[model samples]
Target: MPEFKTEPYITDSHHHLSHQDFSSDIEEVIGRAREAGVEILIEGGGEVALPYYLKNCLSDPYLRNMYFCAGLHPHDAMNFSDSILDKLRSLATHKRFAGVGECGLDYHYDNSPRDVQKRVFRKHIELASELKKPLAIHARKSYRDVFGILEDEGVPEAGVLFHCFSGGDEDLARILEMDGYISIGGVLTFPNAVRTREVISSVPRERLLIETDAPYLAPQNVRGKRNEPSYIRYVADELANLWGLPVEDVYFITTYNARVFFNIDIDHGGDIVYKLGDRLYLNVTNRCTNRCSFCIRNFRDGLGGYYLKLRVEPTPDEVIKAIGIPGEYEEIVFCGYGEPLIRYDLVREVARYIKERGGRVRVNTNGIARLYHGVDAIEYVSNYVDVFSISLNATNGEEYNRICRPLYKGAYKEVLKSIERAKSLNKEVRVSFVESSGADLTGAEDMAEALGVSVR
Candidate 1:
């Protein structure tokens, strides 16, 4: 955390603290924000709050950098009242007043007439322009119309945050060209989330800000439950990982961008993704018997995560506990830096648990479980595991030995023997090759076909 000061400065660029989900423990939520190094909490909402209530909430100094926006949501546009504008005018003059909106079109579920939604959206933008304050917008499935209005009315120079940004490359390009900042949430944590990852990775760090959009879009780690500001770190970590920068640099640039744009200073320190389950990762073992040159753990940072740590290799009970009950994941990968067969009991416990509970499992191996663990390990493991993905980095023994650089003698022969046994198992056994020189691509495929195992 380069901004690794006493506390990381954070500005929660977009959120809806007014939602009912906060009623149970708004103070606890705020406490979590504080603990996570969030200093400023900018509050905004859809047509959710009344103008009068929003005013008092914004006026409270204890709500450090607390702010409000007034707008008729696309769904609530039909119920827009003239008095709401009158109440908003009262707060717009206050210095804490930063923006207007959370208003935009929702073509996916047209809750309000598109024309009515447009009318209300324009009024909010007009209000923002008049106040010279930034505007926070919510646009979805209506980019053309939303941008059309901003262009038509000559949207103010004041900052505009595109909340819940979920668009293709073209949409992002358009918004970036307009000098608009995009706020992202939990969607980035989904498995194989190429689209959101692509958008976040490519977006300029100076123009990027993150939000939990709490009580909604809680993220994959805390999915199917309420979301809060504490989980924003997962978004931060994912973005940091994608950009190939230290989490500290990400915190520095994004938090700064957030404050300047939203006009609030919030702290963002000690944030970590407490929840996990979007990308299925397995920490097979830390004590690898063989030290491959290309092993990821060989790097300094070594793909570290807050929870992705190992004090001592977890026993079967500990590993099973970490895995939780059965059917919670798409794939239970047995591939770790260490050999899966080393902990035969760990696999037996988890595999049995998952088999009885209807879950999918996979084993990424060096294709030599039999020699080390004995022939029976494969017979029993194949009974419970779903997929066995074997690494075939080379086509022959000499190359395999050269590449894997195995410690044990005859490791290559052991790999071939393991593959042969796996082919006869009840699981989908496959051999794979990392693109390498002396890698007989076609010959490997032919060999795989003969072995009755899929080749990648």
Candidate 2:
């Protein structure tokens, strides 16, 4: 097997940096990790390792990006005492301590009684809630019990994660429904781990993370060797293969997910312009005219690895600076969490800039831009935009009212007018409907046909 060293920077979201295996040569381990581009290392293990992890691993100048999580593992549930809880509570207040756990039921090992594991796990959940920190859960042969406990305890707003996840399809569905994250490790690369691979393929990219779980579960290629953070690229490579995306894309997304989940201090990019495949999308604002029931922002913070929530809307110059050169992409798209037409002047200016530079331009709007501005917005943008992909989300006005909940009255009619105006301007007009958002697809197609426009 080839050495996996492709990504410029990567993160091992779970590892045991203080474990005795690396005690003799821990500096060497970290040096190799840095050489392989592993910048962030999160150390988690049973509670006994917490003090050493904080004092040694985190304080090491060479390991500047180290963080730690403190909790009692289920294997040592019998040792869960008030003193340990007190220690964890104290450590939780420290800024470098990222979360609570590696704590959950371990029915497979049965090292501790099942009832004791449950009781201990509940206490950890309570501690996490009190600290307002995420839970780094470790479950084996106890997915149902873990799910039940989390549901009963009520997941904290900090969120929950199943580390080195090895659950099946039903388990994956339940995890997603709870908005929990799944961290994959070297086990994902094992050819015989069919169930783990299935879960990996089914996990939503936004909710996925990668880890080493090092000093254990080394990748099949390095099966018997001691695993370290440097080997995270192998797990990332396997995930890239499973997702059929570039290795860099896998690193970027999973790294982003881990940072958000663990609240790690890293530059999130907070980009105004981001590229997907051949298209570049501009996120000018988070303000939207419609409150769609199925909008992803209601469930999570951002979309497609970019945090679209703008603290302050970027100027047109800022957007252009982010875009660098527009001609490299197939098209410059005006689509994001909000209605791009709200900033009409900016859109027109940027569109003109891109068009002058030999780049195609498209605007994805709710088609109610005219209603928002009380003018024919399509006509205004038609001169600059090559494609007008309007959101004809519902078949009729009544359905539109129920689904889109537009701020303006008579928005559906205004949208239809906007589509007609675009067509009259000789712009390539396409009506788009979110099929999964309960839109009447057949009716939408017929409506598009009547308007002499394409439907997608």
Among these predicted structures, which one has the highest lDDT? Answer: 2
**Best candidate, TM-score-wise?**
2
Against the hidden reference, what TM-scores do the models get?
0.55, 0.84
Span of 10 residues, lowest total lDDT, candidate 1: 267-276
lDDT of 2 by residue, 1-456 (tens): 111211236779999877878888888899899998888888876664455556666764854778888899999999999998998888877778889998999999899999999999999999989999999999999999999999999997899999989889999999999889999899999989987887789898989989998899899889999999999989988988889987767776887788889987534435577666577888888888899887876765655445666667888888877777878888889988799998888899889899999999999998887667776667776778999998888888998888888999989998888888888888999998897787666667788899899999
**Each model's lDDT:** 0.69, 0.84
For model 2 the TM-score comes to 0.84
Q: Give residue 64's error in model 2 in angstroms.
A: 7.9
Q: Write the per-residue lDDT of candidate 1 for residues 105-165, one digit (tens) a residue.
A: 8888888899988988888888888878788888889998999998998776786889889
Candidate 1 lDDT:
0.69
Clashes of each: 12, 0
Per-model C-alpha RMSD: 14.2, 4.9
